[model samples]
Target: MAPGVNDAIRQLILNGRLNATSVMMPAAYIGADEVDALEMLNAGTTRAAIGLHVTLTAPFKPMSNGFAPLRGGAFPPINDMMRLAMTRRLDIELLTIEIATQLQAFLSAFGHMPDFVDGHQHVHLLPQVRNAFLRVVSEIAPNAWVRQCGRVRAGRALHDPKSLVLDVLSLGFKSQAARHGLTTNPAFAGAYAFTPKARFSRIFPRFLRGLPDGGLIMCHPGFVDSALQSLDPVTTLREHEFAFFNSDAFLHVLAESGVTLAQPSGEARGAA
Candidate 1:
């Protein structure tokens, strides 16, 4: 999550529309008061779990600068990094250091380990990055879980090819997590191609219906701002999501699908 990412999400958690969010530690938008308030609101309810959104791509600076793969002190684009990994061109030692540094940043900012961890563009599931992630978690945050992207069948209106590619990339993630004694969400949804004209109202209901019980659905719902637009290409879609989630339509769909929001297991739990 970045600066404007939290506003609508905070409302969703409080209003019972969303239950989880991942935080980007290095983003300039992090506010101590906001995070503290969120923790307070979730104290007993466990309506949401704050997770670390590990960033290993550009438009932001790396916590450590000496990493060999970094371009101008920031990570290169996702595909380029993947190419480097596939060709054995990345520095595994530097990758290890960067991963450790981000985890440490998470701890420092949150004052405790994050409830879970995942990558910005699913980089955590990549070749060398996966090894570095597992190693760091095993040493520093052995009990905290991780997010694993899983494939969803293509529905009429919701077809995100990139999400499918990511799911295929992370095919053995659950088994690998189990091998390392780390828990993970069983299923995943909420991937989109970020088309400006896409109607979330049509797409979201289908998504909820297709989702399995205890499955996890990631979402981005925020008021768009210059900062957000500058950082992300999926700007308008976020507002669309925010509006859909807060509407009565969303509630009706959840009830129709027998989907009740619950915090992922392994955290504090009570009435939300």
Candidate 2:
């Protein structure tokens, strides 16, 4: 969800290669150039879907303070957060406040609510976080669709454990969002193990084949810089993805797969 994390990603949007990106608020604030780049991207005609990337875990701080779990600018590991969820120890109120704070940050930077919202590591789908996320969006940004991770389809390799785990969490998420009067992308893909030297060219076409009509496939494509390399482990792969998507090869793959990239229909997007 950290779309403005680096220039390469922003340039992809500017060049009409990527259709959607998510903002990681603190990252944008800390590196204001990223925000500036986002402004440039938004000014263009690509109509890219810009969304918020909710961060509620380690390596990043919560937008709002005074929450016991994040008191010292320290984010617990994912396992700890999951444990807290299982024990009903998460402070839903604090979670709600932090999410709202991030939403406000997006509004301040972009002059409107996000085109959509999702968690940095899919945390929006986690137990307490999911509840807080749904409630806050329903209040402040009811029109924004939340990402609903659906099952990985047959085209993906069977050994794709990361995608499978995401699928399990995604089960019934659409119903949950619908109950909150929010909409979700019917399916999701573009998750992987991030193995070294893994080729996007090989896998991307498979994902295209697997996607259903109106499905959303998440991506993290950019040119690797020192900043991105430091913040994300999956660095070079971003360049690979950027290359493929920006190339005629990508268009060929889409043609071969009998699929095309398009914005979600207006009805699914709601008011904004």
Candidate 3:
């Protein structure tokens, strides 16, 4: 979304610790230059998996038009979107068009299908939204895996309200994906309070605790720039996460946890 984020991801991929990332097609900085740079970076050797980050929330304009629910020419906030989805008030047809448009943008820019697909704010898990999302992915990029936020193991963070809520919403998601002939990650982690005082170095190890082999851990590591600050409240923490991941301490933590970085397999039973 921002140049800082692009730089951070490029560095992390070069660092050889990160494996996959998703792109926001509607982001302001995502244009010809950025796409060219990313393509060049991904040309040879073992490039990181790139996927579409389906966006249907604030801070971004819709790629497709005729959305009756948009507020001020922008997608509504996550909470409002959730409410609309839960109440069956969302315009599913319009949502599907928007998603398809975004996917088309990704395909147009990358000249290939995404390795996977997921929602920007986990919006793919919402009721009305999930149907539109899955349908679009199945039709446009059937080979891509989808993200499901169900945790397979009970860890200390299991009781955390955010984790519990996501788990509850994720019930029957895997089966839904199967019905659509799409695969999903087995488990998920990496939910935390993005407070200004939070230390990612201390909080990240806990995300690995009890995480299954195929579990996916979400993260947002980036440099702080004016563009990023304008779009997100999760500002400083991105720098913190980037620092931790870029440091030798990250390698030490992985070694201590007996974890090795690897790409998710094609059989849909592993992490990416």
Q: Number of the top candidate by TM-score?
A: 3
Model 3 Cα displacement at 240 (Å)?
A: 0.2
Q: Where does candidate 1 clash, by residue pair?
A: none
TM per prediction: 0.90, 0.89, 0.95
Question: Model 1 compared with the native: what TM-score?
Answer: 0.90
Once superposed on the true structure, which residue ranges of model 1 sit more than 4 Å away at CA?
A: 152-160, 264-272
Candidate 1, residue 254: how far the Cα is off, in Å: 0.6
Of candidates 3 and 1, the better by lDDT: 3
Q: Write candidate 1's Cα lDDT for 121-209 as tens digits.
A: 78888877787787787678877778887844543233567776767767766667778877776667777767867888887766664
Across 40-82, the per-residue lDDT of candidate 2 in tens digits comes to: 6656354477788888877677768786586347667677787
Best of the two (2, 3) by TM-score: 3
Candidate 3 residue-wise lDDT, 64-151, digit = tens: 8787688899999999998998899998899999999999999999898888898898999999899999999999899999999877
